[model samples]
Target chain A: MTSEIRQFLFESLTVMKYSTADMDDDTVLGPAGADLESLALAELSLRVEDHFGVRFEEDEAEMFAAMTVGEFCAEVARRVQTASAT
Target chain B: MSRGVAVTGIGLVSPVGTVVEEVFDAVCAGRSALVRPPEGHALHGVVDVAAIGPAIDPESVIPPKDARVVDRSIVMAVRAAEDALADAAIEVGRDVDPYRVAIVLSGVGGLETLARQAVERSTRGRLGISPFMLPGVLPNMAAARVAIKFGVRGYTSSSGTACAAGGQSIGEAVRILRSGEADVVVCGCTEAPLFPTFADAFGNALALARGWADPTAASRPFDRRRNGFVLGEGAGVLVLERAEFARARGATVHAQVLGWGATSDGYHPTTPRPDGSSAAESMRLALRDAGLSTADIGYLNAHGTGTKAGDAAETMAIRGVYGDDMPPVSSTKGVTGHMLGASGVVEASIAIMALRKGVLPPTHNLDDPDPACDLDHVRGEPRTTDVAAVMSNSFGFGGHNVSVILGRAGG
Candidate 1:
């Protein structure tokens, strides 16, 4: 599951034209690192939700602000597990 | 006459060609770009024929991910904007003040995106609606995306006046420049109405050309046998700058935007006012705005959509304005078909080219002139004459009317 999330994130960022070579667990995803614009980030979120069959709540949307790619994957994985458990 | 607003550069993506010179040359040669849809085209049997051009690969202009969200119409606008800026030799952030450069793009809105999203939502439920849907489908996205891409911070606006939107956009840009709000304005229109749903709308309305054996002859404007317009899709953009500013920058002045006039018919929603009074008033206002008399005009690039009503009404309007001494006139729609919102700018650019090249573009396929449209119609062969001043007219659904005049730069 972790490997799938990482692959998805890498591919999504690549589609946004971000270099995926240096990205890893500690790599920032927002203002601190790739500096993805609002549209790009929204797109990334949508792609992740579509992949994992999970939904990002309104309150949890802002969680992407300072989140790194690794942190994003972990949160998404957690949501996927929760959805399946339900 | 007031010193004209300089048209420094023109960019066009039409059925004719992508480049201004290439399309203008095609226009002068009376080459028809209208073609039969390939087998299994969405609108192949539905519309019988159209003036569909080469498919635009959005990924070629923008990143694949970004292109996935933006409308194809906006992509066409971006291509034309790039060409226009390059032709003017003006770099927005470096050469010109980003805040002082404005944009006025107009179109048929984003019907393609709306249709796709609507279908998705209906089929897959609420979660299927993409977050990018609104931004992708808005008409103003054309202007917004151009500003975002080119860093144009000055006044930006989008007009949605159907076919008249293009002419209105250029006229509004001239107003903005005259008001001293912006030194340079990139103005034009883009339309991608070739989709199946959009084509059906026009087809159901009985507004599109039909039953033509040769698709190339589908759009025969001003011809006696003309039935209706051939639906087309493309964009046309022009770089309008103050005359002094353009001269200071040493830009190549294509022509001068001399005057603009807009009015409403208030007669019918789809059909034009048969009296042609309002359209004539629009042209008269354009002439009045330019401070010129009827005799000063040399040529007219007509909004001849080949519809029986539209062609006759426009002819009546011309007779009302020019009377017996009508100027040599033609309709390039015969070649490129009706581009809807983009038609206004495309025809305007062709008019400017006519002024610069001393050649009057012929109305292709106008082998037999309609008796009602009895004017000095340039047909068959292109007329090589020193055209100094020209007028381009665009009338849209809902009775919107606009006329713009262009003159030889410093002539």
Candidate 2:
């Protein structure tokens, strides 16, 4: 599950044109190197929606803030699983 | 603050041609550069691509390492800026102070590279993402990169007011110069949103023309059969300098930017106000800024995107602003299609050329003009007329309305 989450995160960053070579699960995403701008983040959200078939609450945007690749994937996976269970 | 700004140099990269000379010739001859997309692309009408000349090389303007970080839109802006600066004979690092130079670029779509990367990641997983994605995807990065490339250290900014971005950028640049923030301002817009997702979005909205096999006939602005606007990509740049500065430097002036006005409808996200109040107000304010009455203006470069609502709204706006004594108006979009954010600057440049050459280019493919659009649209061939002052209009999504007035150099 952790590896699956990591794979998802990797794919997300790749789509944003960020190099994921040095990125680990713990790598920070912010205004730093891996940080996506507001427009990019919005686009990323749409992609996530299309990929996972799960609708995220607009308030979850704050949760995305400062999230590392692994954390983002885990959150997405959690939401996806919860949505599926429902 | 009291003085006007002079357009010292102009550069254009459009469907008509890449360079200013080529574009000017095409404009004068009333040639259409709209072409049908390749099969299976799922686009309607014409798609205008950058007319890259064989003699010019992209590598000459941008190094390979730096070029990779930028999208096609940024590349077009840099290329146009280079041409304008060279044409003006402004000696960089010598006669010009880098600190006094500013860059204001307007665009709608930022780095489409990021969006494409997102798609790839969704299908192939995180391992497929590129390292340089973040820096390449930001909208402001284009202006930032242009400033770095040109060594401009002062007042670097960008505007993204949809299609009105270009006009607003130029107006802001002029204000910057007038306000003494910068002595020389490089103002323009570039956009290349021909990506799959963008096409899907526009197509889904029914904003793109469909079922038109012939490109030239697809973007028929003000014509009865006009279905929608064609998507186009290009850049147009103008060097705006204080009139006094231009005179002091003995630079050749193209035209005087007399006044500019911008406003928002606060109405719809995509559709403009049916009453055209906001658009008319912008034109009135622009005329007021120029200290000229509507009677002084000779021609108008319209923001005619070939859309049903847009065309009708703009027509109502023009009639409201100019009343029964409306000037001859034409939409270059008939030939160039809709250039999105770059359309404002491109059409403004065309207006400047018309003022200089004393010839108004016809609205190509407007064989049957709509009775609703009652303005005297120069049809078929270009017309020879003494144009003293001209008004250019650009209204964007989100109800952004911008108007700018330009006059002959001496006028």
Candidate 3:
């Protein structure tokens, strides 16, 4: 799941003229990876939700502020698990 | 209590040409870009000839998916902005503080997107409308897109004053610099007004030139045979900076923005004051703001849109301001066609070029001047003269009038 999220992020970064050679799960997602702005972050969030079939509530959307790609993927996976159990 | 602003760079994406030198030469040579609509076009029979510029390839400028949402006005604005910054030798985040840079763009909003989406909503219902519909058609999107692309975090704004928006944007930019708000500003206007609905509206208003066999000869400003204005499309952007800032950075200054004046006719919605008093006041205000007299001005770029009312009114305004000693005047709209909101900045750029090159561009197709527009009109060929100062005028549909003065570089 972490690898899949990392791949998705790397692909999205390509549209912003960023190369994937340096981007990774352990690398910081924004302000460190590609210095993404609010627009780019929102776009990334939309893409993530579309691909994973999981919804992020207004409160949980702050998970996008997660420092690294791994942290963001973990948050998404946790949300999906909780949703399935419910 | 004000500081002077200098124009360091100019970008043009117009029907005549894009490169500054090429456009300057074309305007001087009296080249016309107006042409009849291609067969099968929606407005082929409804509208007259249009001065359409070269195609703008969105795939090359923006990502495919991103380009799909925004209007072409935003695309053209971004292209012009990039060209302007490159010409100014500015690396926004590297040369100047990103936060101290500003953008003031002008346009008539995104009519194309609005027209298209309205149809989709009517035929296919609410779900057919894209989520990006609102963002695509907003009037401020051009400025916003340029700000986002260039990382110009400071003061981003747009103007929608009918046709005078471009000139007003530049004038507002001068105010911003004078107020010590920003060190640099990317200012101008862009328009994607060639869409069918817009063409139909202008045609329906009887504001477009018609009945000419040769489209190039259709826009004859200041000529007795002139019918009406020709609808043209293009964008022009200029990089403006404080005189001291440009000099300190060893940048090549193109011209100094001496003064700007804006006023309202307050009479009619589309027609200018026939007496031209209010327009004259705008010119006088600009001269007063520059602290210069009539004798100081070298050339006048009239907002002669090849229409009977507009041309005569602008001529009256010129006579009102200059009296018997009218400075040499010409209207490049005969060649470039009226670029609507973008005309002021484009003509201002051409005025700066005239100042730099020492040649007055002629009013193309002005073979027989109208008796009402009797002035020292530069016609037939380019006039060789020393232009120390030039005043460019723009009047929009909603009675908005603007006059901007630019002096030769270095004072």
TM-score of each: 0.95, 0.80, 0.84
For candidate 3, report its TM-score: 0.84
Can you write out model 3's per-residue Cα lDDT over B1-411, one digit (the tens) per residue?
347899998988899998888888998987789888778654576566988877788766666656767888878878888888999999888889998898999898788899998898899664346556776899888888888777789999998898898899999999999998899999999888887899878888888998899999999999999999999988999999988888889999999999989999999989899989899999999999998889988999998999999899989989999997689999999999988988998999999999998999999999999999988999999999987899999999988999999998876
lDDT of 1 by residue, A1-86 (tens): 97899998898788777788988888777778877766667767877877788887655555686888788888889888999999
Each prediction's whole-model lDDT (CA):
0.88, 0.79, 0.86
- Which one is best on TM-score? 1
Query: For candidate 2, lDDT tens digit of each residue in A1-86?
Result: 55775776678667556678988877766556466655455556666776777676666654565787777778778888888999
**Chain A only: TM-score of every candidate?**
0.90, 0.78, 0.74
Ignoring the other chain, what TM-score does chain B have in each prediction? Answer: 0.97, 0.94, 0.98
Q: Give, for candidate 2 chain B, the lowest lDDT window spanning 10 residues.
A: B45-54
Query: C-alpha displacement of B364 in model 2, angstroms?
Result: 0.9
Q: What is the lDDT of residue B48 in candidate 3?
A: 65
Ranking by DockQ: 1, 3, 2
Where model 2 places Cα greater than 4 Å from the true spot, the runs are: A1-86, B39-58
DockQ of each candidate relative to the true complex? 0.41, 0.04, 0.09
Model 3 reproduces a share of the real contacts of 0.00
- DockQ of candidate 3 against the true complex: 0.09
What does DockQ come to for candidate 1?
0.41
